[model samples]
Every structure is written in C-alpha cells, then in structure tokens.
Target: MARDGLAAHYQGEDIAERILSALRAAQGADARVTAEVLAPLDHFHGRGLAATTEMAARLDPQADDRILDIGSGIGGPARWLAERFGCHVTGLDLMPSFCRAAEALNAAVGLSARVRILQGSALDLPFPAASFDHAYSQNVLMNIADKARFFTEAFRVLKPGGLFAVSCVGAGPGGEPFYPVPWASTPAESFLATPEETRRLVLDAGFDLVRFEDRTEAMLPARRRMLEEVERDGLPALGWHVFMGAERSLELVANTVRSDLAGRLTTLELLARRPG
Candidate 1:
C-alpha cells in the first residue's frame, strides 16, 4: 500500500506521552487538557486552529449526526466537532501512532466515548455504505494518488444528503512544491491534483457540489503572521516539533511556505453533498 510506509514516517515512541509533555510545558501540568488547550497543536494544517474552526462552521454538523473524518491525523478536528456539536465522530488515519495518539487525546479531553479512532486508508474506508451523515478531510488529498477511489469511498460512506467538506493544497500552474512539505518528503510520495481536477473527481464520484472556494487569500494572512513570528521569535518551546523532531520539521515548514508563495501550490475549501 502507498500509505503503509507513512506509519513509520509519522511514528515516534510514546506519542501520547510526548504530546502530554508539551501540553504540560505550555499550559502548566495542572491545567486541564481540554480541546481549547490542544487546539493549536492538534490542527496539523496550513492555518492551524483557525482553519479547523472555519471548516467546522461550513460542515454545520447536527447533534445526532454521525461524522466521518478521513485521514483524521491526530483526531483534532474530529474531537472538536464531537465536543462542539454533540456529534458522534469516527476518525480514520493511515498511521497507527496517529490513531493511538488520537485516542489518548480523546480520552484526555473526555471524548473517548464520542470519538472512535481507526487505523486505515481513505481509498478504502472500512465503514459500511450510507454509514455517516457527514464526512470531512483536511490537507489529506495530496498524498492520495487514486483520487477517484478516495472520493468514491467518501461518497459511498455517506448517507443520502450527507455532506463532505474538505480543505487541501492543490497542484498549481507555475511549478512544483518543494519536497518534505507537510504531506510528503519527496515528489513521488505526493499526488497533488489541480483544483479543477479535484472538483471533477468529486462530481464523478456522484456528489453534487454545494461550494468550492479558493481559500489561499484568506489563509495567507494567517500564514504570513506565522512566518513573521518564526523570524522574530524562532520556534516555541512546546509544539508538534516535539514529535516531528525540531531539525526536520523546520525545513519542511519553510519549504511549505516557500512553495505556497511560489505559486506551486494553492489552498482550497470545498463542500459537496450526496444527492438523495
């Protein structure tokens, strides 16, 4: 499987422990490990917490909704949704460590009962057809070369009228993004699609588009502020770097910013609904 090797790339001993240590360092050991405290670090995307917050609003999940989070990462967005909307969330990721970390964090936030973490691939979702009321993914499509399968599985998993919202970095017109970006270390491992192609694939998978927006301009302001902070203050004492390892993460982060600025990548926010 193209995604099987990713588990090693993301794996680190004591992932849950490392995250807890970082949280303690940043917010004091006595502080509660609430979703609010984990928000910044949990969101592993371009705009971080801000992006997740916006995506959640677009989803507008109902209290009894069954939400599916594809490539859920460390379950940050899923946990947030479950807590915020009183929804039941199932989070699936390729990395076992990520699943473990997600479960631990969910437990920490008292969401263990609401959120279920599964280790799996987006191309072949393990859930039954028409199982979920809503599905979403963030920055996960870039790694999936079989765009059709990815979209098809999401579509199949959704109940009629279910919504699938996503935010992703698409292939750009100018050139190619620098290697070791957040999703992949090399070009072969990344399978970015143009925004138009992404839309076509989703439609081909039988979804009706509700909205699609080029969100780069909105994301740029937040990204710029982050870059400025990095230049002035350097990295913070407590963050994902603890797990990603400071040395490699710095370069990957810089490359992502450079690639985004060079027009080699574009950010998009899209919403699609399963036709009843």
Candidate 2:
C-alpha cells in the first residue's frame, strides 16, 4: 500500500516498516491485550470488543442516519460503526494523512459506499447546520482547549432531536486538567471537565442532556492490561502499533498510562439530544 500523504507527513518514510515494528511489539506485549483478536496496534482500535460494542449500542445507528465522527483518527471507530450499523459516516479530522488513510481503509474494506473522510477541525466543520442525524467523538475532546466551542459545533451540525454521543478522557478527582493527549503536548490549553461541567457545556450549547456517566472503571483496566502485556510480551498486542515503533512514542504512551493510573485522568460517556 502506498503511504497515505497525511500518514507519510506525520509518520515519515517507511510507514509500513514503522507500523510493522510496532505491531510485532504489541503482539508480544500482553496475552490479553494482544491476543490476535483484541490488539490496539492493528490501527487505533483501542480497548477492543467491549468499547466497540458499547459504542455501537450507544449510537443505535440506522440506515436513515447520516452520522459525523469528529477527530476521527484514520477512521477506525467510524469504519467499525459503518460496517456494524449500516449507516453513512463522514469522518472529520484535521490531519490529511489520517483522512487519506481512512479513505483507503474504507475502500479496501468495501465500505466506501457508507463512509467518507474529510479533513477539518471540530470547531469549524464544513457541513451546514442540522446536517447530520447524529454525531460522535471518541477520546477526542482532551486535545481541544475549547469545550464551549466544541459542544456548540456539535450542536450546530446535528438535526433537531438528533443525538450527540461522546466518549472521552475527562478530569480526574477534583476536576484536575488532563493534558498532553496524542494531539497535544500540554494540558495548559487542553480543556477537560467533570461530569457536571460537561453537562453544563452541552446544555449551554442548546442540547438536552440525555445521559452521562463515568465509564472510567471499565476502561481503566485497559491500562493495567496494557502494561501487563508489555511486561509479559515486551509490547502491546493490538491497535496501538504507532506507539511501539519509536522509543519516544513508547515513552509518551507510558507517561499517558501513568497519568491515567494516578487518577489525573479519567474517561466517560455522554449523550445529549438536539431538541425538536
């Protein structure tokens, strides 16, 4: 496969070599995390069946739906959702490399009929108002510094009564800021909020809060599982291949995991509805 331009830009020459090296490491990292079926290194398909299953159920997509995925990194979750739910998807990400790679993957998987990848930011989507039946983002918010603008944009693009669902890393105890996500290097401008603050932002954005909950417990185990895999196999098993090839990336991931464990970062799921 020719290197996707955006990936080549970020990953540089020898994307395949780098990816394969990471995958090999992940394969040995953890029997549980790496077990051929659940690896995060395969793409960015982190956490595995449970996360995807939960997402699919929460999305409840339909053939009539036109869904938008914000901050889609190479369209992993978007691809999974389209195939599983049979809905059309428009994947938005700032990185051209990710968009190109995602498009290629969609074509390879014969999902081009249902998926489109676009390059853009969540704060300024190219679509018109109320254009989509639903919108979703996963692990994407922490990289952004503007929750108000983010939620407002999500609101702007969703049709009346449409749903907005998100899974993201949030603040730890006392609502401390969690920072330095893959998209950013500092939490100084990275915005995070508690469950309550999140709700406020959504309501202010003109959406009705449907449900919100801390899902950290379910995912926190993944960190332990990740490190365990590393200890036992020397790398992770699935979906996080990019993190394994370079020592710097590995250190970044390790620090990230450490942050998660220290309760400096937490994760959650939130659902809101555009009122009719």
Off by over 4 Å in 2: 1-49, 174-183, 217-222, 243-246
What are the TM-scores, per candidate, against the unseen true structure?
A: 0.95, 0.79
- lDDT values, one for every candidate: 0.85, 0.68
Candidate 1's clash total is 0
Q: Candidate 1 on 47-129: residue-level lDDT in tens?
A: 77787888888889889799999999888888888888999999999888888899999999999999999988898899889
Which candidate's lDDT is highest? 1
Count of backbone collisions in candidate 2: 19
Could you give candidate 2's per-residue lDDT for residues 1-276 as a string of tens digits? Answer: 112422332443333334445544655544232112322433353454566567768779998489999987766677777776778899998766566666765765677878888888898989999999999888777666688999999999999988988877777774443333443445443566776777788899999888888866666787877866665666434344453244445555665677777777777788889998
